[model samples]
Each structure stands twice: as C-alpha cells, then as structure tokens.
Target chain A: GAGVSQTPSNKVTEKGKYVELRCDPISGHTALYWYRQSLGQGPEFLIYFQGTGAADDSGLPNDRFFAVRPEGSVSTLKIQRTERGDSAVYLCASSNRPYNEQFFGPGTRLTVL
Target chain B: AQRVTQPEKLLSVFKGAPVELKCNYSYSGSPELFWYVQYSRQRLQLLLRHISRESIKGFTADLNKGETSFHLKKPFAQEEDSAMYYCALYGSGGYQKVTFGTGTKLQVIP
Candidate 1:
C-alpha cells in the first residue's frame, strides 16, 4: 500500500515570501495532521483535519499559517509572509481515526533565507 | 496543556547491552502515550503504544500513571536501533493535540 507522500521534498525561499506544502494521505484516511520540526527539537503540532474540515487548529502559531484538506484526502499547508523563524521540516501524517496510530510522510524541509 | 519530556538528548550503548530511554509526560487527563522512532533517511514511524502492551523490535514501554512516565526499554541493544526516538502524548481533551518531546538520539556502538 502507498503511504503518505509530500511534495517538494525541500524548498528554499526568502523571508516574507509565501510557500505551500502539499500532502497526500493514504486512501480512506479521515484524519490528517501537520507538524513543524525545528533543529534540535521534536515535531510541533500545527493543525489537524478531520475529513475536509479542520478539527483542531490551535497549534497553528499565528494567522500567517493556514491549512486546508479539501476533499478529505489531500492537504496543503500555506504560510504567508514567511519569516526566518518559520524555517523547519514540515511533516504530514494521517490516520484512520482520531486516536489511531498515525502514519507519517517524508517531511518537506522549508528554509527561509 | 500537555507536555512530554525526554531527559537525555543522546544515549550511547554497546551492542547486546541493556537499553532504557526515559520519557515523562504531564497532562491534566488520561493520555495515550506513544514512542516514535526515526531511522536514518527514514520517516518517523510508530514503535509502540502503551495501550497495546506489545513490544516492537525488542522495545517495550510501561506506562506509570503515578510517576507520569512511559519509559522505553529493551534487554539487548542492536546497531540498527541507533536512531532518533520521540515520546509523544495525545490528550483526548477538547484540543486533541499530540505533544512531543525534543527526542533522544540512540547510538549503538559495535
């Protein structure tokens, strides 16, 4: 079975620029999650989507960060006016249910120059 | 708020030696504890969960509510076990977010 996949394994952009990271979750997965991992740190929760609607987005640092999982399978994490502090590995995961074991994808490394 | 703590950033042990990776967590309500492992060049994968009560790849973790700890342990270490380990806590509260620790890097010396 195909696991979760993320597009643009690595992306480098200038500060104040905009970037969007895409995620393809496993088929039939109803739960999607986004996380950011900085150097020497673990992955921090960013947002969560149940089906096409976001169930928990409190982890989003600020309004500049937004995510959408329309159609309930694919998700995109959008960052507006990116700051150098936003540079990190963005991870995406999916699960069958809310509390089930999550399957993670190869993270997309975003570097804000 | 929920928090996970991995006291050691790195743990080096020789092959065939016993291994223990400590993890402690703090949460207001009952939480689901998990251990995630990332091998070199591999994505993070679930190693085990406290609720399963099953060992994976010779690794096992026991959850202690009184101590608020879920420590991963194994009787014998293998070189393949060298990787990054993250302890996570998922609280089923209103937010339903999973909190992760900084992670521990395990180095197995041959």
Candidate 2:
C-alpha cells in the first residue's frame, strides 16, 4: 500500500522567498496533519484536516504559514516570506480516522538562508 | 495544556543489557499514549500504543494513570534497537491533536 509522501525531499531558499510543500496522503485516508521538527527537537504540531476543512490550525505559528487540502486528499503547506527561523523538516502524516495510528512521510526539509 | 515529556535525550546501552526510556505526560483528560520510533534513514513509525497493551519487538510500556507515566522497557537490548524514540499523547479534546515530546536517541552497542 502506498504511504504518505512529501515532495521535494529538500528545499533550499533565501529568506523572504515563498515556498510550497506538498503532501500526498495514503488513499482512503480522511485525516491529515502537518508538523515541524527543528534540529534536536521533537516534531511540533502545526495543523490538522479532517476532510476538506481544517479542523485545527492553532499550532500554525503565524499568518505567514497557511495550509490547504481542498480535495481532502492532497495537501499543500505554503510559507510566505520565509525566514531563517523556519528552517526545519516539515512532516506530513495521515490516518484512516482521527484516532487511528498515523502513517508518516519522509518529510521535506526546508532550509531558509 | 497537554504535554508529553521524554526527559532523556540520549541513552546508550550495551547489547543484552536492560533498557528503559522514561516518559511522562500531563493531560486533564484520559489521553491515548504511544511510542514512535525512527531508524536510520527511515520514517517515523509506531512502536507501540498504550491502548493495545501488547509488546512489540521485545519492547513493552506500562501506562500508570496514578503516576502519569508510560515508560518503555526491554529485558535485553539489541544493536538493531538503536533509533530515535518519541513519546506522544492524543487528548480527547477537540481535533484529537497529538503532541510529541523531544525525542530520545537510543544507541545500542554490540
């Protein structure tokens, strides 16, 4: 079975640039989540989508970060005016249900210079 | 506020030695706890969950409600067990968001 996958295993960009990270969740998964993991730190929750609508976005650090899953299958996390502080691995996960075990992707490492 | 804590950031042990990784969580409601592991060049995966109460790969964790702890233990460590481990919590709150603790890197020396 195909698992969750993220595009651009590595992305390097200059500060103030815009970038988009894409995630393809497993087929039939209804729940998707985004997380950011800094060096030597655990993954921090960013946002969650139960379907087409975002069920939780409180973990989003600021307005510059936005994510959308319009089709409830593919998701994209967009960052505006990237900053050095945003350099980290952006992880994506999906599950069949809200409480089901999440399957994680390899994650896209975003490096802001 | 709900939080998961893995106090140890690094743990090293010799093969065949007993191992224990401590984890404590704080949540107002009954939280579902889990241990996730990531091997070298591998994506994070579930090692075990408290609700299942079953051991996986010679690892077991006992959730203690009174102490608010779920410590992972194995009678004898193996070199293949080396990996990064994270403790996570899923509260009953809206969205059922999962919070992970700073991971612990375990090194098993053969």
Candidate 3:
C-alpha cells in the first residue's frame, strides 16, 4: 500500500505571505495528525483529526495556524502571514486508531524569506 | 506539561557492540512512551512502544515510572541502525498530544 503523501515537496515564500500545505493520508486511516520540525529538533505536534472533525488541536502554536480535514481522508494546513520563524518541515501522519502506530509522510519543507 | 528529553544529540558506536539510547520524560499522569526512528531519506517510523514490551529489530525499551524514563536499548548494534531516534510521550488523559524530544543521531562505525 502507498504511504502518506504531501504536496509540494518544497515551498519558498516571503515573510507575511499565506501558504497552504496539503496532505493525503493512507486509505481508510481515521486518525490524522500534523507536526512541524525545525532544524536540529524533533517534530512538534500541531493538530489531530479523527474522522471529519479535529479531535485535538492544542498543539497549534497560534491563531495563524489552522487546519481542516473536511472529508476525513485529506487535510490542509494553512498558515496565514507566515514569519521567518515559521520556516520548517511540516509533517503529516495517519493511523487506524487514535493511539495506534502512525505512518508519516515525506514532509513539505516551507522556507520563509 | 508533558515533555521528553534525549540528552545526547549524537551517539557513535561500532557494529556488533551494545547500544543504548537514553530517553527521559516528564508528565503529570501515566503516559504512553514510544521510540520513533528515521533512516536517511526515509520518513520517520515507529521503532517500538513500552506497552508492547516486544523487541523490534533487536531493540527494546522499558518504562520506569519511578524514574520517569523510557530508554531504548539493543544487545548488539548494526550499521543499518544508524539514523535519527526520537523519544515521544503521549498523555492519554487530556489533549491527546504527543510530546517529542530533540532527537539523537546514531552513527554506526563499521
């Protein structure tokens, strides 16, 4: 089976710009998660979706970050007015259950200039 | 607040030697501990979980509540084991968020 996939492997944009990153989870995975990894650091949890609604979003750093998983299989992470500090690799993962092993994507690296 | 700590940023070991990657965590309640590994050019993947108590790829970890630690260990090191390892903690009680450590890079010298 195909693993998780993310669009636009790399994206470079100026500060204060808006960007949207997309993630396509494995087929039939009900639990989806988003994370961000900066240089020399491990991935930081952002949000999680179970089915069509976000089950937990406490990891989101600020209001500028938002995500939606309307249909449940696909998710989009939106960052408004991106700052240079927001530059990092955004990762997406999915699993059969909430606490089950998660399958991760290759990640989309966002660079803010 | 829940947190994970991997003190070593990098660990180098020779093949066939014993290996141990330290991981310590802090959380108010019982937490599910996990070890995630990322090989070069590969996405991060689950190495093992403390609850399972099963060894994967010759690796195992034990959660010690008294010490608040969950360290990954293996009897013999393999060159293929070289990669980045991350220790994570999930607080099932509330928020359901997983906290990750800074990660340690393992270098296996042949």
Q: Score the docking of each candidate (DockQ).
A: 0.82, 0.78, 0.82
Q: Which candidate is the best by DockQ?
A: 1
lDDT of 3 by residue, A1-113 (tens): 89999998999999999999999999999999999999999999999898999888999999999999999899999999999999999999999987789999999999999
Which 10 consecutive residues of model 1 chain B have the lowest summed lDDT? B90-99
**What's chain A's TM-score in each predicted model?**
0.98, 0.99, 0.98
The C-alpha lDDT values of all candidates are 0.95, 0.95, 0.94
Chain B TM-score, one value per candidate, order as shown: 0.98, 0.97, 0.98
Instruction: Please report how far candidate 3 places residue B27 from its true position, in Å.
Output: 0.9
Clashing pairs in 3: none
Candidate 3 has an interface RMSD (Å) of 0.8
Candidate 1 lDDT tens digits, A58-91: 8999999999987999999999999999999999
In model 2, pairs of residues that clash are none
Q: Could you give candidate 1's per-residue lDDT for residues B1-110 as a string of tens digits?
A: 89999999999999999999999999999989999999999999999999999989999999999999999999999999999999999878666688899999999999
Q: Indicate whether candidate 1 or candidate 3 has the larger DockQ.
A: 1
User: Per-residue CA lDDT of candidate 2, range A1-113, in tens?
Assistant: 78899999999999999999999999999999999999999989999999998998989999999999999999999999999999999999999988778999999999999
Interface RMSD of each: 0.7, 0.9, 0.8
Candidate 2 residue B57 C-alpha distance from true site, Å:
0.3
TM-score each candidate. Answer: 0.98, 0.98, 0.98
